[model samples]
Target: MLRAELAGVFRRRRTLGLLAGLAGLPVIAGLALYFSGSSHGHGPVFLDQVTHNGVFLALVGLVVSGQLFLPLAVSVVAGDSIAGEAAVGTLRYILTRPVRRRRLLVSKLVAIVAFAVVAALVVAASGLVTGAVLFPLGRVTTLSGFTIGLPQGVARIAAAAAVVGLSMAGLAAVGLFVSTLTEAPMGAMAATAAVFIVSLVMEGIPQLSILEPYLMTTHWMAFTDLFRVPISWTGIERDLGTQAVWGLLAGLAAWARFGTSDVTS
Candidate 1:
């Protein structure tokens, strides 16, 4: 079932388009920074230092793309998973087969996870290559008030990329649940994106600080801890825990809805 799901999801032109757009971001960012000369001490967090160490480009790309594009890309796939199939009348047929609805949802969710992993790698790989080509690669100065060697920096970049990639999976689950609520894939996409946008906005408000810790997006940037000297696991641990909670709850909701909902298509 998972194999079949992978085959169908990857075969779509939309999937290719999402990956292409993702792969292009690092090129654009890397080029602009490459020609910009000095760091000027400006731009997204950690981005200004890219000229110093190419490995930082990987971190910078994750930071830049994580803003909106990353979630938007995965949401596009997760948002479309079930609703898109139903929109075209294939969902009913699939349900009629021996494939349990829960199993189907699991397969689709797994596929989304696979896509998210690939997307993160694309950003990290492209950014690293572009940064190396355009600037020097060496030891990295980290936010944790310490310096790390080239190999260590690369390890942190890979680890950070993995965490950031998984962080978006919670949103993917949210999108999956939303997809089950409607037959319009675009609607699901918009709704899923709206949830993140709203959480981000609310996260910025001081009055809402009480609710901040519980918000699904609250700990997203905690991946930055990888650059820390002692490597504070406190926030990253909380971040991954929050994402898991969100995904599990959302997945359960999706299963409940899909299992009980009528399929009239």
Candidate 2:
């Protein structure tokens, strides 16, 4: 069933389209920077330096895109999981095949995570390649104003991307739980996205500062701290830990509710 779900996800035109759209982000952003690196009022002023190193492009892509596009792309796939099947009137048929609901739910979660990993890799790979060709490659300067060797920089970029990818797992689990609640994939997608929106809004409100650390999306950009000298693990660890907690808790919630829920199509 996992294999079948994998094939279903990877072979779908809509899934391919989502990935393709994600890949294009690097191209568009890189080109915009390439042609207008010196233009005033164009992206963050700090971003002008990205034109100097390909590694910076990957960081920039992760920083900018991770805020919205990447999460939204993953949300669509995860949010559609069981809900998509139900909307098509195939949920009852699949259940009749003697497959346990838990097994099916596991399959969907696996497929969603696999899809997210691939999407993250694609974004990182495209950003690196595009940045390499358009900019230059060498040691990368960290946000702390310290420079690191090329190899280490590459390693940190990969690690940063990985952590960012893992953060999305929390969002995926939220989407999966939402998927289990409704047959409408669209509603699941919207509800899952609302998690991010609400988090960001809550974070921006000064009154909510005390509660910010608990939101799953709070530590998302913590991956940026990985580029620092000696490899700052505090933020990265906290972010990964927060994401894991959210994913695990949401997965359990979904399982508990879905274990015996009605599945009429």
Candidate 3:
């Protein structure tokens, strides 16, 4: 069932477009850096620096993408999972097959998560590949002014990527929850994007210091801490914990909403 759901998602034209766009970003970044001469004096000018220094750039891209693009991508797949079928009058057909609503929702959630992971990887891989092809490949300098040898640098890069991938899960779950609230795909996507934008704005307010810990965007850049020479795990752990809590709560909300949702049009 999960396999079939995934197949259905990939069959969509929107999914194909997303894949292409995701893959092309890295190539574009690589070319830009290559021509810009940013790697002129850098050591081991592989894509890592692009990946490292590019973290801020990537975060901005992802945040903007998440605001509308990623959520819409997620909604395009999950938003219609149940409601679309209900709208098309196929809910009755699906229910006649002995599939539990819970099982179906779970499958759809799994597929949404899988897609989010692939989307993030596409972004990360694009940056890394672009860096390798255009920049010098070797040791990378840390944001804290310390240098990391190639081996350690690679490991840190991997860690950063993993953190990035996990961060998107929270947003995916939020989109999934919103998906259950509306039959209009646009509504679901817009609601999810609005939540992200609001969170981002809240994260930026200095007076919201007490509320900062609760905002998901606050930890979105937690991976930046990994780029430090000594690699501070403090921010990474806090960010991971915050994301986990948010993801879990959002997932539970989605499950509850979907389980009780009526298919009546």
lDDT for every model? Answer: 0.87, 0.84, 0.66
Q: lDDT winner among the candidates? A: 1
lDDT of 1 by residue, 1-265 (tens): 8999998988989888887888788788878888886568877788878877777888888887876888899888998999999999999889888679999999999899788878888888888898898889988898966899888888888888888888887898999999999999999999999999999999999999999988989998888988889898999999889989999999999999998899876
For model 2, the superposed segments whose C-alpha errors exceed 4 Å read 39-46
Residue 112's lDDT in candidate 1: 91
Clashes of 3: 11
Q: Give the TM-score of candidate 1.
A: 0.96
Local accuracy of candidate 3 as per-residue lDDT tens digits, 1-265: 7898899777878888976776665566556665675655553323334634443334333433434455456556655666666667766677768678777777777777778667766666565555555555556677787777766765665566567656666666677777777677666766776777788898778998899888876776677678787778988788778877877888799889877776665
TM-score of 3: 0.79
> Model 3 Cα displacement at 20 (Å)?
1.9
Candidate 3 off by > 4 Å: 39-81, 87-91
Q: What TM-score, over all chains together, does every model reach?
A: 0.96, 0.94, 0.79
Residue-wise C-alpha lDDT for candidate 2, range 129-211, written one tens digit per residue = 99888988988888788899988887777877778788888888889999999999999998998888898789899998999
Compare candidates 1 and 3 on TM-score and give the better one.
Answer: 1
Ranking by TM-score: 1, 2, 3
* Cα lDDT, model 2, residue 168: 86
